[model samples]
Target: MYKLKTKETDNSVIEFIESVDSPKKREDAYQLLDIFTETTGYKAKMWGPSIIGFGAYHYKYDSGHEGDAPLVGFSPRKAKISLYFATGDTERENLLKDFGKHTTGKACVYINKVADIHTDVLQALINQSIRFLKETYPNH
Candidate 1:
């Protein structure tokens, strides 16, 4: 059974964000956390060392590789933040068209700052990404 992950004293994720040494980045981290929760309807939790993750899902590919992963997450990189979605495609081209100049790597979307992109569009992308994953791997 899944249980809510309550606050912890040793939250490496929060600590990492606080250690960024940049007020803008720190503020961005909090904004991302709020946006992620509001968009996904899933509470956020720290995953591993420096990821803010929302919800969870189990996956089993046809190749037999399988594991559980946070339904959605992001890492506050030094130069930019990376949002992790399950996939990417031309379908999101319209949104990306005005994503304020960013790069995409496989399943991750890299952005310099939250202000650089449209918040509503970002939320839309996150929501769409989650829905895609759930539909693609319903068992998860």
Candidate 2:
């Protein structure tokens, strides 16, 4: 099995984010770093190259694939900022409806730009996501 190299080391992660060309994107990433740290009560760490991750959780599925991952975090990708929340089964659709302006994947919420969304809604989403992660992955 091969693990994704997106997150390989902390220094690499910092370097990746710091190297982003846009000041606005860098500032947005910093803002998210602050929020994820505060909300998750976990010191921000580079998950690999670009992910600013929070708490760690161990997960095992019925098929037996298991690994550890951050309880919640985000990656400022080239196209959008990917906010990671572990909820995938009907946990935040209501909030998603009014998430200002964004898109979603199975476990990620994507924002084209921080300014494109409402900060208040984003805060609520992050708060809700953190609570859900803590409840779902208590030991992590």
Candidate 3:
């Protein structure tokens, strides 16, 4: 049985943000905290050691792997700020066309800083991810 490594914890989201090595990244993290919280209407929570997540849903795959994950999240890493969103949403791709100065990998959009991207598009991505997840995992 495979266990999930990124389980939600009681750790302090603020403390984790403060521990980020770069001051600029730390500030961006704070701005993101506010943006995500306000957009999702859910308080941020620490997911795993590094991810700051808002809201959550349980997902079960066809392979019988099931677990809970945040509806949307972000991590201010050393290289870039990773924005997490739903993996299979076509709307996400459409919105990202106007997102500005960002790169995407499967489920994350990486940006150098908050100013590099449009916050309105960010909020749309967040909302879309939540809506998609809820519809996909209606029972969870």
Candidate 1: global Cα-lDDT?
0.77
- Model 2: lDDT equals 0.75
TM-score of each: 0.83, 0.83, 0.98
Candidate 3 C-alpha lDDT tens digits along 40-102: 999999999999999999999899999999999999999999999998979999999999999
Give candidate 1 regions above 4 Å deviation.
1-13, 88-90
RMSD of each: 5.1, 2.2, 0.6
Q: How many angstroms is residue 64 displaced in model 3 relative to the true structure, after the best TM-score fit?
A: 0.3
State the lDDT of candidate 1 residue by residue for 36-95, as single tens digits: 989898877777666788877877768676667787888887888988777644557667
Q: Model 2 over residues 51-115: C-alpha lDDT tens digits?
A: 77777776676777666777778898888899987676364787777777888887788997777
Best by TM-score: 3
TM-score, candidate 2, is 0.83
Of 1 and 3, which scores higher on TM-score? 3
Q: How accurate is candidate 3 locally (lDDT)?
A: 0.95
What does candidate 3 score on TM?
Answer: 0.98
Candidate 3 backbone clash number: 0
Task: Tell how far residue 50 is off in model 3, in angstroms.
Answer: 0.2
